[model samples]
Target: MLRDEKQYIESLRDGRVVYYRGDKVKDVTTHRALRAAVNHASLVYKWQADDDKRGLTVYKDPENGDVSSFFKIPRSSDDLIERFNLIYQTTRFGRGTFNIIKAIGSDAIFALMLVTRRIDSATGSKYAERVTRFYKNVIKNDPAIAVAQTDVKGDRLLRPSEQPDPDMYVRIVERRKDGIVVRGAKAHTTQGPVSNEIIVLPTRAMTEKDADYAVAFAVQANAPGLKMISKPERAAEAAMNDEWFVTGKENVETESITIFDDVFVPWDRVFLAGEWQFAGSLAVMFPTYHRFTAISYRAGIADMFIGLGKLLAEYNGVDDKSHIRRDVVELIKYKEMLRSTAISSAMMADLDTETGIVIPNKVLTNVGKLIANESYMDVVKHLVDIAGGLAATLPASSDFNNPEEKVYLEKYLIGKKGTNAVERARIISTVKEIISSFGALYTAAMLHAEGSIEASVLELYRSYDYKDSKKLAMYASGISEKL
Candidate 1:
């Protein structure tokens, strides 16, 4: 079912325990700090209801009527390409901020579908059946979801069970006949306060000794004993400004430290209980789907950067300068390079014969994500260079609003030939929001969001075809004679 914006907002009124700034939030949908995020997340529903964009956000499922395009599983390369378009366009719609409320949850669901099939095939378990049923319910209700995968490890060198504090990682503390009780916490649970459900996955591979920790399941965001302590909103002060672009609600996002204190998950909701061996497979498979989503959204953000650079350059009367043109071209190259990797990843996808699900090319996806992670700074550097020093030291909206200060700012801030002072200041304010205030978090997210730069580097080494390269080197160097 495709829920409209009002229905989506009302859904979060459930009695969930959420804290912000050490105070219990009475209503997330109406709270000052959280309302922007809720509104940002509701864009999915808004787009789905719009006749012009309905095709991009949703599709007719003969069995389920109209469902979100997010829940559609990819069976062929065309389907994967469609998935790419949905993600890319939605991020652009959100003003370069990807709404993970559905995109991320679906990424987890896709990974779960693929891994559970392998587990059931090897052990004759009915895990696959449970996942399908849960997936169907998600589609029918169109509930917003948040994925909680990163565990807060007390010590970097220790495993889940080996931690000085066992609760450092979320684990099954007790096994009841009807369900299992989970305890511990997940950090960086993006959009947790606004989501209806929270899907949990193992943060890393497990061993026989870590059987209790190798669990994957879904639970209500308001489940008994579950608590979400949310981080403060980013650029809160700037969002209050009267500037056009910087004040949009769609630019906000919220994350939380979600704690599960003896939370119970019924057997029906538990997808993996003690399958220690397949834990790593589930951990790795999720990022394969998620990194593709990452690169897609990053492409949209790149588009924004490209536009911002050009707009600022034109405002500063430097659009025709050769060096400025070169930098702009570099930004264009950065965007297209990330985009090409996404297209290549989809086109070179592999079909999982057992389940008939098409998996994006793993190596190419990582390569794309790596480029997005590493080259983001260069994107920022180029934008800052194009916009000049005003990006960092622009006068606040308050200054522009004061009649006494407005007179001076009006005359002094004017730019180029046709632009007014207020117009130039607004443009510079938008750039400030991106490059300095909220952009600090955004810059870090690009490097560490899906996984770290090191994580992608490690995956590339593990998955790339080094043996063929080695053989080619041997042939070229005449080392074959020794063999």
Candidate 2:
């Protein structure tokens, strides 16, 4: 486990593990776009070691009774609540670029708790104990880790075992007395290649026939036989080469696709295998935890945008304008709604089947995610409105370098009489970078990631407590309800 942020950055600097775009990246730490994101993530680890975030970021692991990072294991309902609060706090520090790092933390912490509880109940295995130990180590020594969840999904309609291309989903292809060999690729893995470690798990619920696909394990990012592919650089990549930081906003980090080419996993690291019955339970539990985390963390992101909107409105001398005021009001309401849902979910947490990992209630968890989806988009829309047309039409940060265009940029971009022309231009370019670059992509991901809004609604519909509510309604009306 990474002992501190220094090691985390060192790992990123120590590169070259078959990560490809069109060509392989020899070292991700120095790359123009990827480096900024890596530095951003390192801040999370660095915070754990700093005196300021110690209270929020550090927690005692119940198993080893050692103080670990709050991102490690959420064992009690209180543990879950504390973690829920931590993400909200961290959002202010990074302006929400740190959201995905916490997203990975949510999945790893909750899944370890859920699975450890289940295994402890079923076979009285030390799996839960081992997990707690691992978690404590990570917390004691903060690490930058990522979770791999999505499968290549060869044919959306076909199950993993039923797919003609068996490697479409990451699955166990061979088992030996000492370990297992896995093949296939996982897509949309948040910060997979740059992370210190990667937690691997089954992508979906599985049946008995799909036993080979129901596997879970954890490994170092540099583990042999693993390859990654990120979304190709945007058309904006060319522009970034010369001026990545000309805009105050950093270039967004890339999340790569990870392929396991018959990778060997040691027996000790393998947490689950062929537990087809619990496969659905695992899949369901992941979203419950992830959605709750998103509710709080993404709201933190909206909080950032709202603050930005207010600043921009004032700088532009439009804060007193009715439309801008109205937009700010709407934005604040959306942020408040997301905050409420996340807090409610955390407050309503419960214990699970085994390792005694406390999880948020399923119905509210799904609702939390839905609220995030709706609120995130609304906040962005409001920000866009308050920002006015300049949000779209601003010149690139590079234009400031030109002798001729610099004067026009200064004159035209001036926001208020008190502010210097250059400062106004800088702020406008930063806003554009926020709205146009990979950071923009992160906002879109908040809407669709961790399952779409439609999917969340379906989950809520299935878990609705309709029967009890219906019976109560009938009694209140003095009418006898029959089955």
For lDDT, the strongest prediction is 1
Query: On residues 1-483, what C-alpha lDDT tens digit does candidate 2 reach at each position?
Result: 324666777866555474555777778777654666666676666776778886676655565443435465556666666776787877767655544664575576567666767766887766666666666656655556678878888999999889999999888889999988989999888777677778887878898989988877877777788887766545236346436333222424567888898889887777777776667776777777778777777777777777878888888899999999999888788778877777777677676644556777777778778877866666667888877777778766678788899988778777867877766655555556667654546666877888888879888998887997888888888796552
Question: Candidate 2 at 183: error in angstroms?
Answer: 0.8
How many clashes does each candidate structure show, in the order listed?
A: 0, 3
Question: Per-prediction TM-score, please?
Answer: 0.97, 0.89
lDDT of each: 0.89, 0.71
Q: After superposition, how far is residue 343 of candidate 2 from its true place, in Å?
A: 1.1
Clashing pairs in 1: none
Best by TM-score: 1
- Model 1 per-residue lDDT at 340: 89
TM-score of 1: 0.97
For the record, the alpha-carbon RMSD of candidate 1 to the native fold, in angstroms, is: 1.7
Q: How far is each candidate from the true structure, as Cα RMSD in Å?
A: 1.7, 3.1
